[model samples]
Target: MKLNSPSRIHMGLIDLNGELGRVDGGVGVALDYPNFQIEGKESSEIEIDFRIEIDEKDKENLESRIKNAAKNVLDIIGETGISLKVNDAILSHSGLGSGTQVSLSTGKITSLVYGIDLNAETLAKITGRGGTSGIGVAAFETGGFIVDGGHTFGEGKDKIDFRPSSASKDVKPSPVLFRHDFDWDIVLTIPKGEQVCGDREVDIFRKFCPVPTEDVQKICRLVLMKMMPAVIEKDFDSFGKVVNELQNLGFKRAEVGLQKESLKGLLSKLQEVSYSGISSFGPTIYSLGDKDTITEISNEFFDKFGIEGEIISTKANNSGYEIIK
Candidate 1:
């Protein structure tokens, strides 16, 4: 049997440095991409196929991670009888949510093959893929401009409370735009290298972050009041400014090695040319501008850097993913 799934790009609005007792929140938008397909299914065994390009170092770990995630999905849905052969790749990493997309596609295929009644939120939890940044899971479950409520954080003893209490509960994600007629284009610049945000980095950054209660409250207020509303209105200028400011502030509080150097340089250049905002974690820099501007800027950046990267332009997918059989 063969199955098909949809893929998406994540618009980096906020950084994820402060998600779980760290510093602030990571805000992002989900851009729908025309990539995703799952083929071959059987009662005893299944084969998964997907195409995505990322840094070579992450390839091995990514493959294993996805396979485990797929197995987790099957186990959570009570379909442990099936064995999976997952063949996955990352087409674009820095800007697109390739990792999350792969897990979602895998989970969706497993549900279809096994006859499971898992909803979007339930599936997201089962996969254990999109809790830190829910935008990726939102895009996989429902493609479009999604504003996730973000995860809660706690101290050492309170860590257990942070886990999702009800995995099966439906989370109605807010749509950034209602009509979906916004004219926008994104140019993703991923430096040719591997940038890892592992457990060590997270711990180091968390240790350095300020512990004042007022600071966290202020960041939350800005996210709810200023950032979210601007995105809903499709005001690119205000949105870009607020997002950049938020990331810059968070970066200051973060440790020195949290973000990669190449990503920082690319972001500097993109900001000079007036794109939108940069990616949160590592080397993926997303520049948002009109078609003409995006094209011209992308060409100039590629020519100057002399590196091979992907440049894709797409609109907000308000309609989400559809089954085309």
Candidate 2:
């Protein structure tokens, strides 16, 4: 059996730091690019192929990771009796929702092959893929501008609780086309290396965060007043400014090194020519603009920095993941 699943890039809007107990949630404007394809069986041997525009030596490592994910999925399905194969996943991970995308794509494939009728949300919860931000999984299942209320523990396993806050709780997961009109062209600058955010780091950062209730309230205000409005109005200037400001504020409050050296260098270069914002965690930076502006900035950055990156031009993907068979 063979299956193909599309990939998406998260154009971050608001950072949900104070609102969510775990990692800060960002309102994601999804893009259409990079798709995943799964081939072979669900029994003994599994093969994964990650298809991307860039060519590099990292394919070997990606293959290993994909195979492991597939194995895990099979175990979760309680079907180690069957073998599975996943192929042609994407390279963008750790920074953007790469892991989530891969996991969702794999889960979708497994469900299809096994005749299990699990929806994207269910699959996401079962696989523990979208623990922090459910938007990634929602985007994978259904693309567009998404605001995931975040996650909550459920009684036993059948019933899952989503979105503790009323604002996010009321907003269901679906495609936002007309209302949230965002012109989405993003420049993704990922520094070559690995930086993982473990539980200990999260714990330390949370412990050190300011206890004053008012301070946390202020951060939430910035997200609602500054970030949300910018995205809704499709105002790039306001959006970029707010993102930069919010990121700085979050980093300061957390007192953690949010931007690494390579990412900082890339940001400096982009700032000289264009407006850009850092994605969740560190390393992967995104610059928003139209097609021409994005292309120009991407070329300029490559010429100056000689960095391995991608210039993806796409609008808000109001249409979520579609199965092409």
Candidate 3:
């Protein structure tokens, strides 16, 4: 079986403040470009290969995620052999939610090879993903603009502390509160910058959260009042305004504040043309508006700043992943 899954832009996490009894809510959209593509077949033993050329470090990371996911499925189903190959992949830690896409894709293919059916959320739990935000998992499942309800907070609940997904593995995916087809042009600008991960990412969550209650409330109001309505009505103007506003609110503000000055400048330049914000952590910035204008501005920014980066102009993937036999 061959599978193609969409990559997602994690706009921001909402409600990092646990005072309301729930935390880690998220909002994001699924993109059609920069996808995860893999092919799997039953084998005598587990094996993984890559069709596309990738750096050794990236290759190792992809292999580790694929192997771990396959092992999880094997251990659960008492089935042990599958050969998987990565035909395509998105950059890791580029804030594109590539990790979740990689894991879920591998798990889904392994499950199918063993004749076991599993949805993305089930595969995520089994493979230990979707702990902090459901945006990536939901993007893989349904593909659209998605809002996750987050986890119950406090002692003896889904989560008691603020942590990234890698640190909160046992928690299941948060429930999706709303989903709608997002029909706006999206531009992804991934500049060469610090890719925050491992201990640093965890520490950031600890240090900067729980975010201020006022900021979380502002984000909630923006998402509920402006963003949701814009998505449903296909009002690009309102949606773009909210996207721009989110960069300076709640946990997202902290995430953006950590970026290098060059990246910050780049984001500011893009925003002058359209609504722009960093996707998840740092590096991969997304903008919504006319693709030509955004792409042009991105190139100009890179040229003027002497920064190496990638820019992809794409749109929403409302249908999620596709499977082929």
Task: Return the top candidate by lDDT.
Answer: 3
Each candidate: what lDDT? 0.52, 0.53, 0.91
lDDT computed for candidate 2: 0.53
Residues 5-59 of candidate 1: C-alpha lDDT, one tens digit per residue: 4444443323333444532234555554544454435455433333545446666
Candidate 1 error regions (>4 Å): 1-25, 49-59, 77-89, 92-95, 155-183, 204-218, 251-262
Candidate 2, residue 239: how far the Cα is off, in Å: 3.3
What's the TM for model 3? 0.98
For 229-309, candidate 2 gives per-residue lDDT tens digits of 777776767767755554445433332145555557666657655666565554566666454765675566566666655
lDDT of 3 by residue, 57-156 (tens): 9899989999999998888888878999899999989999889999899999998887888998899898889999999999999999999999999999
Candidate order by lDDT, decreasing, is 3, 2, 1
User: What's the lDDT for residue 217 in model 2?
Assistant: 58
Cα-lDDT of candidate 3: 0.91
Better of 2 and 3 by TM-score: 3
| Candidate with best TM-score | 3
